[model samples]
Target: MFFTRKKDIVGIDIGSSSIKLIQLKSQKGTYQLQNVGLVPLPAEAIVDNTLMDSASVVEGVKTLIDSLKITAKEAACSISGNSVIIRKISLPVMPTEELEEQIHWEAEQYIPFDINDVNIDFQIIAPDDIDSSKMNVLLVASKKDIINDYLAVFTEAGLKLTVVDVDSFAVQNAFELNYNPDPDEVIALVNIGASVMNMNIVKDGISLFTRDVQLGGSLYNEEIQKHFGVNNEEAERIKISESAADSDRLKDILARANDTLAIEMRRSLDFYNSTAGEGKIGKVYLSGGGAKSAMLPETVSQKLGIPAEILNPFSKVRFDEKEFDPDYLKEIGPLVTVAMGLATRRLGDK
Candidate 1:
C-alpha cells in the first residue's frame, strides 16, 4: 500500500518461529517457483506476533536470502495479530480522489488507536449501485511502529520492502491462485502459525469475516514441554512424534491440544455466523505449520461440522521436480501457503 512494487519481488513471511522466503517467476500467467527457503529463529526473537529480538530477525532474513541465493532485493512482507485491523465498511458514494481524505476522517470511529498511529489502506469491494448512496470498502490498518520495525529490519538485512500486507489477505490470495471456489460456497481459510491462527471466511472470493485467534503450534509445544518435562526444541520433536515418549500419554496430551484448537476455531465460526448472517461454511482450507498436526483436520471438521482439507498452495504453481520433491512439496504445502500467496503479488495489484 505504501510503495510501488517492482516487477520482481520476493515474498517473505517473518513469523514468531521462523522466517520464510519464496521467489517465483511468472510466464504467460503461470507462476513457476524460482527459490524457496526457511530459517528457524530463536523463540526469543518473536512472541505472539511481537518482535522481541530484532537482531535475530535481521540475521534470519539475511541468512534466508543468502541460502536461497535470492537476488530480488525488493520484497513483500505481511503482518498480523492485534496490532493490525481489517474492516469492511460502507461510505457514501464519492469520487475516487476524495475517498482517501474521507477515509482518514471516517476511520477514527472504527479504529481503536489514535488515527495518526496507524497506516491505512482501503479497497473498493462493491462498486456497484452507482445510483445508491453508499459503497462497500475493505479497510486495512497496521500500527505505524510495527510497520516501521519491519521496514527497518528488511533494510538492515539488505532488502527493499515494497509491500506490507495483512496475513489473512495473503492467504486469500494464495487460495484463489490454487483453487477456484464455487461462486455460492462459503469457505474458511485458517492459517495456523506458531503463535496465532488467521481465520478468514470468504464468499465468491471476497473476505467477509476475518479473525486472528491467539492459539497455535507454540501452545502445543508448551503443553508438551510442561507435560513431559522437556525444553522447547525437544518438546517440538516429541509433539511431532520424532522423539519418543510414552505413546499413550503423548496421544492424550495431543488430543487435549487438538480439542482446544478446534474450540477456538469454532468460536470464530460461530461469531462469523451470528454477525455476518452468512450461511454455514461448506469447506475449510487449513494452512501453515499447525496444520501439520495429524488429527487437526479431523478435529476441526468434527467440531465445525464442515469438511476440512490441507490447502495445497502449489496446486497451480510449477517447479522442477528435482529442485523440489513432489513428496516434500506435498508435506510443506500448508507451511508455505501464505508466502506462496505473497509471491504471486504483482507490481500494482489491488
Candidate 2:
C-alpha cells in the first residue's frame, strides 16, 4: 500500500480549544488550498495539548473530515507540550550505528525521563569545523505514551498517519515556506497556540534554539471574560474583533491581556538568548491563531525591541479560483501556518 503513489495528504492540527484541518497541493511553485475545516473540541477534551478524552478528539476529527469531504487517507500530524525535547549536540565522528548508540547516553544527560519511556529520533546536522572528528547532530524525543495516545485518536478517526512531527518543527517548516530570511541572521518563529507558545530561533535555516512558554491566546480570552463578566464566546469575540474598535472598556481589557503576552514572550526570549549565547534573534515571526489579533504585532515589537510581523503562509502560494476565499483566508491565514508546514512534509530528508 505504501508505494510510489503520491497520495493527497491532509494536515490536521488538534489544538487545545479546536481542531483545524487543511489540505493543499503545489502548482508551479504555488500552493493551492484544496480543503479546510474547523471543529470545536468538547469542554476539557484536551488540556495543554494533551488529549484527556480520545473519543472527543476522534469524533471531532471524523466530523471535520466528513464535513470537508476530504478523501485523503494519509495525514500529517504534530505533537507539542513539555514532554517533547529537542537539542543539537556535538559528538565524535563515527559510523551511523555507533553514533546512534552513543547518542542515547548523551540524551540521558539532557532528558529528564527514563530512556525507555521516550521515543528517540535524531538527525546529523553537519561535521564540526573545530574538530574534524566530531559531528553536530540534532536529537528529538517525545514520551511514547503521549504519542501512542495521539495515534490512537487518529486511528479511531480512520486516518492513516504519515508523519508525526513535533510542533516546533512544523512551525519552523511553515515559516521557512513563507519567508527566506538571511542565512547569517537569526529569525525567531513564535507560535502562539491556545495554551502554549513555542519560540524557535533559526539561523542559516537551522534551528539554533527552541523554548516553550506556558502562556497563549487562552490567557487573553480568560482575562476578558473575567473582567467583563461575559461568556467565553463573547470574550473571544471582544478579544479579536472589538479590541481594535473605539470602545474604551474593550481597549483597557485588551491592553492588560497584551501585557501578559508580552511578559511571557520576553521570558522565553530571555531564555533563548541565555541558552544560545552567540546567536542573537534578528526578527520575530508571529504565527498561530493568536497572531491574527490586530494590535499584537506592534505590542510584541515594542516589548521585545525586535521587528515582529504576522506570518502569511499563503503569500507564496497561488490560489485556485474555486479553492481560495480572500476574506476568510485573511482572517484565518495565521492559524494555517502549522498545518501548511505539516502538509508540505516530504517523506524523508536530512
Candidate 3:
C-alpha cells in the first residue's frame, strides 16, 4: 500500500468589509498558526455576497498573498448570503450509491432555485441502533453563477480552489476543534458577519436548523453614521470602541441597532424550538466582526434569555507569543473564526 500527501491549503474568507487570510500547519492532528492577515476592502467590493468589484477583490487577495508570501497553491474558501441554501430533510432508507444518483432529484423539491441553475451536494446522517424506515440528510445548494464568480476571482488571484464549504459549517468545525462539548448538549453557533448573520443550531453533532438573516455589524455602522454624520471609517471606530464624545447617544444608537438583531434572533430561535423539537439551546456562541461590539453578547443574551458569549477560535490552536502579539490576536479572534475552520480542512474531507 502507498500513502498520499495532504497538500497544504490556505484559508481565505472574503467578506463584504474585509478579506481574512490564515495559514496553519497541523502537527499530530493539532493546528499551528503560520501566517495571518486582515485586509480591508471597499464596501462596494462585495455587496450582499455579489462580487460587484472583482478587480478590487482580486487586488486585495493578491496583496495579502504577496505580503504573507504564501507559497501554497491550493486554498479552501467559503460562501454565504442569499444565494446559498441549507436544509435538513428525511428520506426513505436507501443505499449510498442510489442516494448519490438521485440527490439532485431529491433537492429539487426543497430548493427554491431552478434545478438546472444550481449545484447540489448532500451528506447522509446515520441513525441510532433503533431501526427506522427513513434516514436524515443535509442538502446544500449554491447558484452556479455565484460559483463561477468565485472561480474567476480565485483564478485571477493565482490559486486553486480546492474546497467550497459553507460559512455556517466552517464555524461549527472551528468550535468542535476548540471546545470539545458534550454530545448530549445543544449549541447555537451565531456567526454575524458584515452584512449577514448565519444562525446554525447543532445537536449531537448534527445541524438541525440553519437560517441566514440579512442583518449584521453593518447595522450598527449605519446607525452611527446617520446619528453623528460621520464617514464610514469613523462610524466603525465609534461603534466598536465607543471612542467618541457622545457616549450617551452613541450607546443609544448601538442599543437601537442591537435591538433589531436581538429581536430577530428571538423570533428565529423560538420558531426553531417550536418546530424542530430540538431541546433548548444550551448556549449561543457569537463569532464575527460584528461580535466585537462591546455589548452585543449581553444584549443578545438579555433579549433571548439564553447565555451568549464571544467565540475565541485561538482557544485551542498553537502559536508563538513572540511571533504574534497576544493582544492583537485576541482582538481579531472572532473575525478569524471562519478562516480558522477553513484552514482545518484537508483535501477530500467532508
Candidate 4:
C-alpha cells in the first residue's frame, strides 16, 4: 500500500511562472480541499527554478495568501531545476549505524559536489531479495544556498516551512497517494514547467533514472513572441487564453511547443532506455503547466512508444466541494502534483 501516511498541511508549489498553494484535510481516506490559490510570478522572481529575487517571490506569496484567505501557518514546498541531484546506489544490508558509515564511502562514487556544501539524505527502499546481501537506497542532495533561499521566502511570508522536498520525489509522492501503481512497475513521471522539464523513473517505489531538460513552457512564449512580435505578457495571455479571437494563435503556439517538447522527450527516453538495463519504462505521467497543453500527451505518445497521459494528483482522492470549486481544481490539478505530494509528507516519515 503506497501513500498510507496522511497529514493536514498546505502544499505550496513555487514554479517559474506562478506559485500554487493547496491545503487538504484528510478524513477517512478522503482529502478535503480547504484552500487553493495561485499567484503569478513577477518578471524575474524565479529563473530556472532558482529564487533570483526574493523580494518579488515574498511579495507575491504574501498577496496570494491574503487574496486566497489561506489561514494555514504550516505549508510544504519543493525545489527542482539545476540545484538538485538524485542517485540510486546499492549498499550491504546492515543496521542503521553501519549503513550510515557505509554511505560516506559510497558518496565518493555518486555525489559530484563536496560533502560540506550539500545537504544529504537517504530513504531505504525494500531490501534486495535476489541478492539478499544488498539494499536499495535513494540519495538526494540540494545546495544549502538553494534551500536557504526557499526558507527565506516562507519566513518573509510568515508561513512555517513544515517540509521541503525535491520536485521529482514530490511527483512520486503524489503518484503514490493517488494512483498507487504496482511497485514493481517501472513508471516515468515527467514535470514540464515554465523553463525546465524533469523526468524521474522509478521502479518498486525507488528512483532509478533522473534527469532535467532545459526546455519548457517559456520556450512556447518566446516562440510566440518572436513569431507574432508580441510582448511577453501578451504572448502569455494568448497561450492560455480562451477567447475566441485567440483560438488560432493558441493552436499555432501549441503546435510549435509540441514539436519542441517531443524532441526533448525522445532524448530523455533514449538516455533512460540505454542505461535502464532490465528496467523498461511502462508508462509516462505528465504534469506541470506545460503538460496541460492538449497536444502534449499525444505528442509524447507518438515520439515515445509508451502510453502517455495527463496526471491529476487528486483523481482518486475525494475533496469537499463546499470549500473548493471542483471545476477550478480540476483545471489546475496537473500542476499541483508536486505541491500535493510535499503537503502529504507526514511528520517523522523521513
Candidate 5:
C-alpha cells in the first residue's frame, strides 16, 4: 500500500469529532482545491481511534460527500493513535529487495503486536553517515482489526480506499506543500485532534521523527464542562462563542487546560530533543480542531520557547474566493491539513 500510486482520490479524514474530506486537482506543480466538506460525527462514534459505531461513521462520510457534491469515489484516508506504530530503526545496509524480504523480521522486535495480526510496511531512508554498514528505515505497522474497521467504513460508504496513511505523515505532506520549509530548519507539525495530538518533526520536507500524544480538544471541553457545570454541548458552545456571558470564566478554564496541554507538549519536545540530538526545532505549526482553543498557540510558544502559530493548509492551494469564504477557511484551515495532504496524492504517487 505504501508504494502504490493513486489518482483522482479525495482525502477523507474520519476524526473523532468530524468527518473531513478534501479533493484537489493538480495544476502544473501546484494544487487547486476543488471540493471541501466537513460533517460532525455523533459523540462516541469513534473513540480512541477505534470505530465504535460504523454506521454513524459511514453516514457521516456519506453526508460530507453529498454536501460537498464530490463525485470521486476513490479516496485516501488516514489512521493514528495507539493502534498504529511508526518506528525509525537502524539495520544493516542491504539491497531494496533484501530489505523488503527482511522487514517483517526486523519489525517483530519493535512492534508489540503479534506479527501475524498486524500489517507492516517499511521505507528505506538514507544510510547513516558515520556507519557505512548501517541504514535508517521507517517502519509502519497497524493492527489488522483496526485497518479492517476503516476499510469496512469506506466500503460501506461506497468509496474506494486508495491509501491508508498515518496522521503524522499526512500532516507533514500538507505542511511541506504549503510552507516548503528550509532544509536546515527542523519544524514540528502538531495536529491536535479531538482525542489525539500527532507531532511530526520534519527537516528539508522529510519527516525525521513522529509521536502521538493522548490529549486534545476534548480535554478543554471536559474542563469547561466541569468548571461551568454544564453539558458537553453547552460547554462547547460557550467555548466557541466570544460573546457568551460566561466568556471570562470559559477563558480561565481554557487557559488552565492549555497549560496542561503545553506541559504535555513540552515533555514530548524534550523527549524528541533528547533522542534526536542537539538541533532546536525552528518553528512549531499547530493544526487540527484543538488549534482553535484559546491561548493554545501562545501557551505552546511560551512553554517550548519556540515560535508557534496555527497552520493554514490552504495557504498555497488555489481556490476561488467567491466559492468559499476566505475567513472561514482560514479559521478551519488547521483541521483540514491531513485531508489536504491526502488530496495531494495521485494515482501513481511514489
Candidate 6:
C-alpha cells in the first residue's frame, strides 16, 4: 500500500534560554495553528547563538515535539548572531542567470568570513525607482559550521531539515503574514532573546536592514540576581513580579538595565536611518522573551522616540479557542513570532 503525506513543515526556534515549536496547517490560503510547545533549556545550553551542548538541545527539542504531538517530519529552523551576515548591496543590473553566476564573486567583497567557510545566497530586491543601472540585492552568508550544528540537532531529533533561515527574516515572514503593513510603512522588528537581539527593518514587506546585538534579557536576570542576592531562577521570578522584598530598589535596577538596552536599540536605529536613507522607522515591534518585561515597551518608546508594542504573530492565524488559553497566548505571543514565521514555510520555500 502507498500513502500520501502532508506537506506541512514544523517550525522549531531553538533559543539560548528556550526551545519553541510551532506547527500550522494551510487550508486553501488561510492558516490554522495545529500545535505549539515551549521547553526551557538548562542555563548555558546555548550561548551567543552557539549550540554548546547538542545532546541537551536534541533532548529538549525531542521532548517538546513529543509533547505537542507534532507529526511533521520536515522542520524549518533559523539562526542568527555573529556567525550570520546579511547585507543589501547595489549591483549592476543583470539577468538572474548572470547574477547567480557572479554572486560568489560579489559576496566576497561584502562578507567578512573566508569565502570557502560560508554558504552564500542572494535575492534580487526591487531596484531604486530612479537608478536603472544599479539593482539592489540582498546577500546572506552564514558560517557552514553553524549550519551543520543546526542540521545535526534536528537530525538527532529525527526530523528532516527543510529550510534553514535567518532569525530576522523568519520574524519578518511572520510579521508580514499577520500585520500586513502598508507598502510605505517603515517598521523595525526587534526580537530580544536570552543572549542576543535581532533587529530587522522592513519597509513594504521587504527586509531592508538587519543587525544582531549581543544584549538581551539575560542582562536583566543577571542584574536582578546581583542586586537581590538570589539564584538565577529566583532572580527571574522576582524580575517579572511586583512583590520583591525591596520593590523600590528592584525597580531602580530594572530601570537602569532597561535604559541601557534602550540606548543600544537607539544606536541600531540611528545606524539604520543613516545608512539605509530610506526613512525613519515609524514604529517598533518587540518579540521574544525580553518583550515580556514589565517596563520594556514603555522604556523603549520613551527613549527611542518611536512607538513600540509587542507583536502578536497569531493575530491573523486561526486556532480553536478551547484548545489554548487566549490570555496566556497573548502573554507569550511575542516569543513565538520567529517560530510562527518558520512554520509558514513549506518544503521548497526559498
Q: Which residue pairs of candidate 2 clash?
A: none
Clashing pairs in 4: none
**Per-residue lDDT of 143-216 in model 4, one digit per residue for the tens?**
87888888889988998776778888888888887787776788989998888898988777777888888788
lDDT rank, highest first? 3, 6, 1, 5, 2, 4
Compared with the true structure, what per-residue lDDT tens digits does model 1 show for residues 263-312?
Answer: 99999998888877557789999999999986999999999998999999
Model 2, range 291-333, lDDT digits (tens) per residue?
Answer: 8765888999999998999888777766665666887877787
User: How much is the lDDT of residue 280 in candidate 6?
Assistant: 84
| Clashes per candidate, residues 3 or more apart or on different chains | 0, 0, 0, 0, 6, 0
Q: How high is the CA lDDT of each candidate model?
A: 0.87, 0.80, 0.87, 0.79, 0.86, 0.87
Give per-residue lDDT, candidate 2, residue 293.
61
| Model 1 spans > 4 angstroms off | 127-131
Worst 10 residues of 4 by lDDT: 1-10
The TM-score between candidate 6 and the true structure equals 0.96
For model 6, the superposed segments whose C-alpha errors exceed 4 Å read 1-6
Q: What's the lDDT of the predicted structure labeled candidate 5?
A: 0.86
Query: Against the true structure, what is each candidate's TM-score?
Result: 0.96, 0.92, 0.96, 0.91, 0.96, 0.96
Q: Could you give candidate 5's per-residue lDDT for residues 167-257 as a string of tens digits?
A: 9988888988888676899998999999999998888766788889888999988987787788988877877773356777767888888
User: For residue 319, what is the lDDT in candidate 4?
Assistant: 69
RMSD of each: 1.7, 2.8, 2.8, 3.2, 1.4, 3.3
TM-score of 5: 0.96
Write down the RMSD of candidate 3 (Cα, Å). 2.8
Candidate 3 off by > 4 Å:
1-5, 128-131
**Per-residue alpha-carbon lDDT of candidate 6 for residues 1-350, written as tens digits (9 for 90 to 100):** 00024378889999998899888989778898888888889998998889988899999999988888777788888989998888888999999899989999999989998999988878888886678899988889999888888888899899988788889999999998888777888999999988999999999878888999999999989998888888999988887674598989888988898898888999999988887777889999999898888789999999999899999988988989999878877977888889999999876455
- Model 1, TM vs. native: 0.96
